[model samples]
Target: MCSHYEAPENERLLAGFGVAPDSKLPIDLWPTHMGPFIRLRHEEAREDDLPELEALTGQFGLLPFWAKDRKLGRQTYNCRSETASTKPSFKSAWKKGQKCIIPVSAFFEPDWRSGKAIPTRITRTDGGVMAIAGLWEKWKDPDGQIVHSYTMLTINADSHPFMSAFHKPNDEKRSIVILPNGLIKDWLNSSVEQTTSFMQPYPADRLKVENRPG
Candidate 1:
């Protein structure tokens, strides 16, 4: 449910969205952190900002290997929950709590046709922001530069009466991780039981998703 989230270089920006830099973006990699992570897309990756990247100090992470190497994302960007239980790509985070919440203004999902992609906006019922579920990991390069990368989680959408209208992939094959505001913490805690309970839909009718001009 996320793709665009910003914590503004200033700490104040987070308070409005209910995130704190010490806890979330500019990303503090502390093991005891909570809250959502804003994935920096390929276009958002500002290599010139090494200082901001260095300032992060590993507060949070993504798939250590995949994010470090772009080649991995050809298959790594979105992990299917149906196969997650067995897919080698996501087995580790599934069993463990190396997870992160992906917060966003709106998530971009495509309605695929012959070859073109039609993008839509799926946001909270109240036109507010949201957090998508994610998994994080950290790895080091040959020269010792640490890279923290992550992948967004997905779930089937047939259950979502509104989302299904968009023909979002259901079948438990590929769905994005979305939770009500209250459950964010429980998922972050990520105990074997907590994660299991989180997988269920959050009462679909309560949320609203409308299609915008493509």
Candidate 2:
């Protein structure tokens, strides 16, 4: 299972984000170290957190879709790479060919705080940017508040040499999906059946992991 993911707040804010139609793409801001706080209604942020976010993302000319309520994203963000077509939240998007590509310089993941763990950064070995495949949706609250959010998908680490260990920790759980630029476009535009074929190991040899940097 996947848990957390990382992206550049600046890219989401500034980039036009080329994707198919009807995709409800959602991008958050970065704090100081992380991107900006694009993740409103996090585990604590509330639903009425649009004005502030609009200001931040607007600076870079981004169209930020605020979260409607806080229930779905409170826990349901990432859908598994293998089963996204069957899940309720993702199935619709998958069927309509609604997909987007998230650009990233690297991904941040914390090693287990307990057991055999340490902090690290997983980035492209070639030191280039990556375009991760993700699904987006628009949902609303009982009061008719509309919000848009997206999730990162993950698959089993079958060939990733360094990441296989990151999939499971002693008494802890962690792992994320990192798509390379080579296959990202196809992943975003392909049919549901075609997309599943691209969920393979995500090209482990193209990535490198180490203590967090940048």
My TM-score estimates for the predictions, one after another, are 0.65, 0.62
lDDT of 2: 0.49
Residues 34-83 of candidate 1 have per-residue lDDT tens digits of 22454232325556542211112232223435344434544555666666
Segments in model 2 whose C-alpha atoms lie over 4 Å from true places: 1-5, 9-68, 112-116, 142-145, 167-175, 212-214
Clashes of each: 13, 10
Mind giving the per-residue lDDT tens digits that candidate 2 earns over 1-214? Answer: 4333344444444442321222222343221111221221222343554221121111111112343345445354456766777766567767765555545556655555345445566777776656555565555546875545565556665445666555335433324555655655456557766766766566667778756333
